[model samples]
Target: MSQKITWKDKLDFILFGWIINWAFPQYYRPKYHYTRYRKILLINVIPQKILGINRFVKWPVHFTSVIHSPEKITKGILCDPGDNPGIYIQANNGIIFGNNVGIGTGTKIISANHNKEEHSKHDTTSPIIIGNDVFIYANSVVLPGVKIGDNVVIGAGSIVTKDIPANSVAVGNPCKVIKHNPPHREKFTREEFNKNIPKQYHHYFDISSHE
Candidate 1:
């Protein structure tokens, strides 16, 4: 004997099908703008874990974007999807991101580049490895074969052309390290964080607690 499928079960099935469709390139290529619709659907379907939605929805990414090998890209918890302009990832080799990695708007992490000698030919592809608790700001570009270490912060509108060591703040066109051991709030507790918050924003926090 088999049990009847409930309404919840049917809904679950539909959502699962939607996710499967999003994962494949063929379905979304024709309707690239519809990618935003899928992102909204996922947010509505699951609200409790909205902050960590990117891990499942993979939003802001158009279907046309090439993810040559899905298995090669390893993302971690609380990973944010690219912002409005979205991210462009060319993972011919592989790209690994550690926990709490935040990729900002219009960011592109490319693992392969064209060869200098042969303009038509691509250079040897290399893997991009990002360590835990890294925050890459908006409109930044990380070039091929770069490794960013843990607790690193990348400023907006910078281009990374080389490997960045851990616990440093890097910025500029060539992305030079400007400071070491930048201040981070990840280790602070909720109370501690609130205490350190600027006075102007305190009123907003108060209102939020009332709600």
Candidate 2:
């Protein structure tokens, strides 16, 4: 930790942390959410993203988890970075991933999709968004200008290029919805199923429950 600290350098640790918290999440989150709505995920990250490194008491701890620069993630937000390791957003606009998003191994998001014509692409880029509970399989590429709705499952080795509906299962290049998840619950009736439960003998089939 001492090697990372010096008097000559700006060592306003607490102040820098507050700045990171107040500014970075706010800046990136908005654009990230918007890009999702627009179905243009995979865009280069916006700018000035803060992961609260300034809030850390130990320099070594903070440095280990830090991602890339602000310019790369101009205005994007990725909650639960602990689970989504090696995840990076590179977009010109916004890229947002909702909570509980299970992105499988070796997934790469390339958000910056510009016009093939170099002249027209100079100032144009798209975005990408993955909703909550969305499961992206391994080795998947989610391109720019794409949106994956909630409860969606992306097949492994698929390339997503379009907008997916909520509760849908999509697979293949330029992914398409193969199935939609329906609301489901499990239940057992007394006639054929309740007998399996020991009733008053044990409420949960456990001797302790009778007590």
Candidate 3:
């Protein structure tokens, strides 16, 4: 037998939809959309947003993760960087993330290196550029000014000190590329890359300004 929709059910649906629209502006057509709302209502969104915990992070994130200079960090559509616990992002210089990037639990991305001459000062450099469809696994550390290329998989517990080329699977303390898994991945210029990201995900613009 089919259950009839009551007025209360309609109200609940409308309220949930409103919350989702307000909170996640870039999440247009999120997968399993209704279920995501249920999870947000039950598990993730309340304490972090309402209790003033992780108040500066605009995205839906795990309460245990920390983000410094969130204004300097940029990400693509539906790319929730610190959704996993124990994740740390220090974007004092800047950190640019491409589309569909996944950051695992305990991962740390530090964008500014400390000066060799002065321990109190940070050395200036370009932003840590992470390319599209990249998966930085659990406990991995991406050091300052490192550029990870597109379609790359960084293994668990790896420390990335240098730039990694595209379509590679990298692992180890120094984070060397072991193999190029997808040889046929497409290449994109910096302009094209930036263009590929949705306007809602841009660091310069406020999420609410899109609508």
Candidate 4:
């Protein structure tokens, strides 16, 4: 014989329905949803159990600086998703970030530029793409149409005016490639790399002497 549906089961079903309605009311109404509240809580609250601090510490500040098309900004795993003073992301087109991307405090990424001749009009709006294992230091500005490649390090207070190639360290007011290969990874031997890295991360590094 099948088990009878108790009043407790009915109550659980009602609670579940209520939660869904409360979280996603956009399905029924045409109003601005408080979607970021859930995201903020997930970023701040859940991580504290394991990390002992908020994972996205600057999420509140970052959320306010996203001017246009905030939904188009996509970030990857293990990323510090925000800035301290705040980073301006005018994602009118889109901004795509790859895995292990760390954006430092006070970095601004402008995806749209105004016309030089006509100040009132927009010149062009394009996407900004930042690749995997990239670190953009504080107070740097990435202009519209800039594409930063994988395994790149951008120095502090630099202004990125054009596309940056992979596996380079760039710096200056208008950022320039100072080194072909970043010094940090080049200096380490396989044994040193394995020994220095945590046990969980040892699999990512090759055991051979030559990288």
Task: Give one digit per residue, the lDDT tens place, for model 4 in 35-143.
Answer: 3334433443344323444222323333333335556677643344452446666776688776557778788888878788998876666689998678999989999
What lDDT tens digits, residue by residue, belong to model 2 across residues 1-211? 1123344223332334334333323322222111231111111121212344423211111222233322433221223331233444344555666544556656666666556677555344555677755678877888877888766789998888888988888999878888877532222222322012223322222233212
Model 3's alpha-carbon lDDT is 0.74
Ranking by TM-score: 3, 1, 4, 2
The per-candidate count of clashes, in order, stands at 0, 31, 0, 0
lDDT of 3 by residue, 42-120 (tens): 4456756677666667677778888888889887764777878899999999999977678999999999878999999
What Cα-based lDDT does every candidate model obtain?
A: 0.60, 0.47, 0.74, 0.59
Supply the TM-score for candidate 1: 0.58
| TM-scores of the models, in the order given | 0.58, 0.48, 0.76, 0.56
lDDT of 1 at 29: 19
lDDT for 197 (candidate 2) = 26
Q: Lowest summed-lDDT stretch of 10 residues in model 1?
A: 25-34
Candidate 1 lDDT, 1-211, residue by residue in tens: 2345456545543555455344421121112212343453454334312433333434333332223444567665434334334667766678887655778777888888888899887777668998766899988999888999878999998899999999899998999999996544443222422013334334423423222
Candidate 3 similarity to native, TM-score: 0.76
Cα shift from native, residue 75, model 2 (Å): 10
Candidate 1 global lDDT: 0.60
